[model samples]
Target: MSETHVPARRVVVIGGGISGLAAAHRLVDGGAQVTLLEASGRLGGKLYAGQIAGVAVDLGAESMLARRPEAVNLARAVGLADRLCLPAASAAGLYTRGALRPMPTGHVMGVPGDVAPLAACGVLSDAGLTRIGRDAELPRDELGEDVGIGTYVAARLGREVVDRLVEPLLGGVYAGDAYQISMRAAVPQLYEAARAERSLTEGVRAIQRRAAAGPAAGGPVFMGIDGGVGGLPLAVADAVRAGGGDIRTHAPVRRLARTGSGWSVVTEDGTALTADAVVVALPAPAAASLLAADAPGAAAELGTVEYASMALVTMAFRRAEVAGLPNSRGFLVPSVDGLTIKAATFSSHKWGWVAQGDPELFVLRTSVGRYGDEADLERDDPELVARSLADLHTTVGLTARPVATRVERWDGGLPQYPVGHLDRVARVREQVAGLPGLRVCGAVYDGVGIPACVATAHTAADELLGLLATVPAA
Candidate 1:
């Protein structure tokens, strides 16, 4: 039998975030020469970790949903399965109306399956409850176009659900204004459920029925690595390097030009690298800036994708300081409550392994979103940290001041999938498809999660490899 010869193809991947790293790893595994360029000195874009009181704390994404298989599969492939850890389930509180109260039971992201807990829990008034109950009889919109999550929820579930429950819960995830986020992009399943069942409650019931028949329904709600969420990025980087990819930090790509044969990528150091293919896995704004001249229409559509800034403040406290705190994960702050912090995650309670069973050490991570209020995000780190601690004290009766604090600011970290995001993204995709040997993959296009980014990168890599295979041998 004759041997099939495959020519080597050089590929350049811009950005060193999870998406970019995943793309580089996938390309390298597919027998391509990969060079990953990161603007910063580190590989992980938003995934950062620092030591606090001798404990490693993740300042970026705290955990991953086990039901999302992409991240877990990537980790397992990279030999990081042993590092995985599950958090202990605990009650989550909600800071609303100048007090902290327990979140209603059977409430999935503020869309309640059962209204009894919300009514009995007093998260909303009798009038608010009545308004929510009216959603069952609310007419469904047959237009089927994408709508703002807040608008849809408010119109159907009432203002209380949007302002108190949805805003705090979903807002924390995207660091976006609920009224501005796309209902289809942010929570497509919710929209699907609504479409299938007519009522939000009934839709949730259907999902519950499906989940009950699945394996994850009885498992832990969230999972993380023993070291921290940072481990995921590190594992990805290791996989990329092991697969013969060149990962370079502090190497910012200045511009990308279409060469006769392929693409020429010029870096900040004034060096040009010609590659058979290029994968741009940066934020939409950065990607647009790099691709404007070559792919003008795509760049324009990419520019329409908006992003919001955020900061994560991790405070470490002594266990004795927060004596009466419940053994629960964390609490969210409703916008109606006029709270400065968006949400607080009990790092110690959520992931017991992260704390190494140190009863005296309690780690709390509070998030500040820059959606409607960039001013709040502009506050000094110390002031923001102080405010978060005070709110924690008021909400959970934690009197202990943090013994150590770490603050991480992510400027334009989360991309907001607005009402027309899907259309714009579709247009961007069409524009990119017009150019050969070029691809753009990232959270801005599909989803803004570790799993989604990895999956998108894998798909992009597969497409690029298929393109390489079609090329004649030199």
Candidate 2:
């Protein structure tokens, strides 16, 4: 008997970010013919690699959580395994109380697991420290449905903890206000702990104990590429092409429609691409615009998702000029501190590759702006640099001029996850799932981290592979 040969499934992935690249790589691996469409001239979305003062550095996102296997595994699959590097300096500090204080240990995202360590850090005032202890004495507070991280934590630990400790840490991730961010979506472990335990501090300690016992306990918390984390996307894109996937840049997808047996993706120049499966890997807004016709419910939910804009001011200074700079990784500034710059990373100190790239040049970057607080983003690049310098001077007493500077602004860079965000995501997925050969994945859905984005992309691709397996290939 003669065996039948199945034709390859045609898959189209919208957006050229890490999510899209990852999806394309997985789809190609599944024996599908994939085409990746990127609206921009480049592939990496937030992961951007650039140079200053003849030294290579990351202009966008710099690191990924090492505990998450998705991103690191993807990097290994893309030939970057040998290039992986760990952080040179892991200790980070908080710039508050008119000084740079060490980040407190025994906390889960700024929620104190032990009062001794929290008090030792001194990020919070004496009264704030006392307020955290009260969490153990308070009556059991039910965390019904979903609640804001800031609102729930403040009720137990007071606003001082939320402002001084929580805000800066969460801001580093989402660039969002702590009071409005979703507890379930942002920190699910803490949310579950709060539900089971009355004392928030004990709940946090339980979490810490579990983490210590876990396999990832002694592992590095974060990982960086030898050159820059930004290079991951480029490497993934290269792998996709090597796997015979067609990747296109400057190919802005204008519309998407459900065809009789599959989907049709039309680009800005009116180029139509037919696909047996489609993965919408763009940001929330872009995904909303494309899904409006076929998946209106998902489109509406995506439209409701808000974003935060921020700018990164990268400066390279003479090593001799910045000797007074702190030897630690860097410091985060709380919004309550009334600072223009939110956080600063001592790149040369934090990444060994950066220091090795240029012995005489010291590089660092300062982030500015967040949700509902972006007036400083309107400032010119020079002014942003000056503002960063001023903040650095105030915090570290640095009064040196930079040899090279670059400002990178990301408008609508981060998605805000308010209360009920997980429900919103579920609804979107449910609606999209109804449409055969259609899936969505991005930072706007699972998480803003590189690993989360890659994980979502892999899930989307694997689902499409299964769906396409049942379809009659053309």
User: Best-fitting candidate, measured by lDDT?
Assistant: 2
Q: Report the alpha-carbon TM-score of model 1 versus the true structure.
A: 0.95
Per-prediction TM-score: 0.95, 0.98
The residue-by-residue lDDT of candidate 2 on 184-279, one tens digit each, is 999999999999877888889889889999999999999999999989999999998998899999999999999879889999999999999899
Model 1, which residues run further than 4 Å from truth?
A: 1-7, 357-359
Off by over 4 Å in 2: 1-7
lDDT value, residue 112 of candidate 1: 81
The lDDT, on a scale of 0 to 1, for candidate 2 is 0.92
After TM-score superposition, the amount by which residue 126's alpha carbon in candidate 2 deviates from its true location, in angstroms, is 1.6
Cα-based lDDT at residue 8, candidate 2: 77
Minimum summed lDDT over a 10-residue window in model 2 is located at: 1-10
The best candidate by TM-score is 2
